[model samples]
Target chain A: MTTAVLFDNVSRHFGVVRAVDRVNLDIAEGEFFAMLGPSGSGKTTCLRLMAGFEQPTGGHIEIFGETAEGVPPYRRSVNTVFQDYALFPHLSTLDNVAYGLMVKGAGREERRKAAEDALAMVKLPGYGTRRPGQLSGGQRQRVALARALVNKPKVLLLDEPLGALDLKLREQMQEELKSLQKSLGITFVFVTHDQGEALSMADRIAVFNEGRIQQLGRPEEVYNQPKTRFVADFVGSSNVLSTKLCQRLGVKAAFASLRPEAIALAAPSNGALSLAGTIAGQSFLGATNRVVVDVDGARIAVASPAAHAVPAIGSPVTISFAARDLHPMEDA
Target chain B: MRSEKSNRAPLSLKIAAAAGLAFMHLPILLIFLYAFTTEEKSYQFPPPGLTTQWFGVAWDRPDVWAALALSVKVASIATATALVLGTLCAAAISQTRFFGRETISLLVILPIALPGIITGIALRSAFSMADIPFSFWTIVLGHATFCIVVVYNNAVARFRRISGSLIEASMDLGADGFQTFRYVILPNIGTALLAGGMLAFALSFDEVIVTTFTAGQQSTLPIWMLEELIRPRQRPVTNVVAMIVVVVTFLPILGAYYLTRDGDQIAGASK
Candidate 1:
């Protein structure tokens, strides 16, 4: 796939604070790329820079091989779905959706037809006459999507688009937005602080921290083999064991990251690393039972089948995992 | 289930508020009431008869017509000038930040905050120093000084309420700067501008102190009213015009209040 959006060493600073520090990223055409991070991690700043709402203090941004410097946002071939879904409250849904086409000076009939088609694409077939204030939160969000998508932008930027919805609605919109992105066949650069939203939607995820990308890879690759301690702690729940190299296990490094699902309660019959522990706590989580095991003054969380027999609190148990399960990081 | 005590204010406070409202409005209301009365010479409460002759008299007077026409001309010109300058100032101030922004904003707001006599005196001084002739243009200039503040306050407040993301969204969707302003920013602030224009027109229409200083021999409606009060030919006719001013000003104020009632909702939508 061709690169659709590229950020070349883009850095943005506000006085003494560095919001987006020398970030390099390339989003592939038709790929849903998500920037995942905690609040204040500069993911939003990167999105703003790409949208041209903010100018980078240094470096360059390109969309469709065109340098984006000194280009006002309105002249860009990208659209953003704001976190609050900034729909025009005074205008009806159809008018709001038709705004871009109207600005392009399209004929009134043509713009109306296009707006109707776009609203239909978002499954709000005939709610065109209603104002944004009259719509529900989910409907308002869909209107925002339709308004942006109606412009046929080369890239669609979503800044925490589903951040305002309730959990069930958010999950539904996530799937809807993913399918929408796929059907449109346009590059999507999504920014979200929610790891689950990023993981579920993105073809690849860039995990950010302190104004830099800590790791960027496919969701499973980043989750299964996180590059840093921050990534390991951020991407998914893991029992990150900080250990000094007692001995070299082949060519792998000392510090190990064992996924919760990979650790087994049964003792190792074969030559695998084993640790004796007591079940500190256990909780049933529908399909799985998460047990916190206290091992050598360290807490390691283990997830097993819900039907698996679990020891009582303070009961002694042996936790074992194979060498391959321990994905060690080369650098601390 | 509400207690009566909760509904009651302190007796002194209630009496004070009543006194203040009465003091402000009693004369204006009396003017309206007497516009229909038959009294021709001196002021009298509970006049001997009621007639609508004063409206006809005020309407027919050539001097009243001339003064009214001049007031309309000055007010329209001042309001138009203020709207253009004030909206531009609001847009410029809203988008970017630099040193002395607060000071500049304070200066913009200062004309309306200061006593009208002070603004009148300042305008008179400035015009005299520049050797500008005092004509209808001078009256417009004086009225626009305070009128710009009205328009600017309304426009800036509305601009501040609008989401920056909406403008960004417009641009991201392939709109140029002018297109964004035309479609997005302009539509969002249209009501605000209308409301501001109405208020500025009202202020300019009724302005007296500033017009007195700057108008020289030319007479606006308020300056005409001041002259009519001191040397009255038909006293009831002046009251009729005063009633007209009240009605004209009242409508726009009501319209402005309704226009801004949902302003918070628009602001909340962006957050």
Candidate 2:
């Protein structure tokens, strides 16, 4: 496969702080990729780097087959849907979408038709006369999407595009974005801090921590097999098994990740590994109840279905899981 | 708890409010009243008589017309000069960062902060030192020093309120520098520039002390009115000119107020 964007040991420093430090990454053409991390993890900085908004202090960047460094954003074959929506408040929706074409010296009539078509593509047909201030939050996001998409950039950069929307709208837009990417076959680079968004949308995920990529793989691989302790904790709140705890359980001494859902609170009949502990606390998640068991001094969480019975707090309990379910992880 | 009684103004406050209004407006009402008085000479309140003849005399006077023409021309050119220079200074200061940016901004706004007489004296000396003859252009030059400050104050406030992302978005959509400014920046700050230009024009139209220094032989409308007051010709005629000057300046200030009235309602960056 061809590389769409490449970062070769890219580094960006602001004073003494390294916002993006020595990062190496590649995205395939037409791939749906995600950069996921918490705030100050350099995820947003990386996105800005790709958009040509920030210059790296070291290393090189390439977009498609062309060198990207020192290239102004207007010259690059990429467009961004900004986090703030950034629609020109003074212009009508049609003019805002047509702005790209107008700047390119297209005929007025042709640009108007193209802008209208783009608006319709984002399911906002006939919204040409309304100002951005007149539209609702979700509608404004769709307009922002249309304004970027109208340019037909080779790559689309989305910086938390759904962040401002309410929950139902965010979920709806996620599904819509996935289908849009599929139909258009354009490379989409999405940056976000929400694990669920990254998991539900991106074909491949890169989990960032302190300006470094802790793990990079498909969603299934990243979730089922986290390479580092940070990835397991960040991706899905998996219980980290300390090397000391592994030795106590009569297993090889190594750091391992155990998902709470994988651990069942029931007596094992087929010689499966089991840990004895007291039920320290219980939280009622909508679909599953999370029970935190105090095994020795380590707090191990177990998620059981809502229909299952939960023991009272402070009661003794046994949590069971197969030997194959405990995946080893690095101490990082 | 707030009550209907609390919402109503106290009687004492109502009397004070009326007194303040009378203090401010009664003089202007006096000017309007005398503009129509039939008497050509000095003070007669509860005017001895009233007639429309002074309006005719004020209209026919050639000196009055010359001064009016000069005032309009100077104010127009000064305002245009301010719009260009003040807006550029504001953009340079607000949109980018460099050494001494704040110091430079302070200097641009200093002309209006100083007392008008100080500014007038400074300009007179500077022009005489340069050996530039006192003329219409000299008066315009003096007027621009302060007119530019008015525009800069308004333009800078509006520029700071605008989001930087709008410019970035324009570039991301393939707009060049000039195109980005035209399509994005200009539209967002358009009303502010218009408002600033109007205020600058109004200020220059009725300016007195600065014009006195720069206008060597000629008289502008306000300078002419000053001369008319000291060495009296027709006191009522001066009042007629005063009424016209008030209307000319009031229209623009009123327009500016309406244009920028909904400042808090300006759309914000998406939350």
Return the top candidate by DockQ. 2
Q: How well does candidate 1 score on lDDT at residue B192? A: 85
Cα lDDT of all candidates, in order?
0.87, 0.91
Candidate 2 TM-score, C-alpha based: 0.93
Each model's fraction of native contacts: 0.69, 0.71
For residues A254-278, could you state the per-residue lDDT of candidate 2 as single tens digits?
A: 7888899999999875968898999
Stretches off by above 4 angstroms in model 2 are A250-254, A267-271, B97-104, B128-135, B262-271
- Interface RMSD of the predictions, in order shown? 3.6, 3.2
User: What TM-score fits each model?
Assistant: 0.90, 0.93
- The two-chain DockQ for each candidate, comma-separated, is 0.49, 0.50
- Each model's RMSD to truth, in Å? 3.1, 2.6
Q: Which candidate is the best by TM-score?
A: 2
List the lowest-lDDT window of 10 residues for candidate 2 chain B. B262-271
Residue B225's C-alpha lDDT in candidate 2?
94
lDDT assessment of candidate 2: 0.91
lDDT of 2 at A297: 90
Tens digits of per-residue lDDT for model 1 on A110-217?
A: 999999999999999999999887899999999999999999989999999898899999999999998988888999999999998888999999999999999999
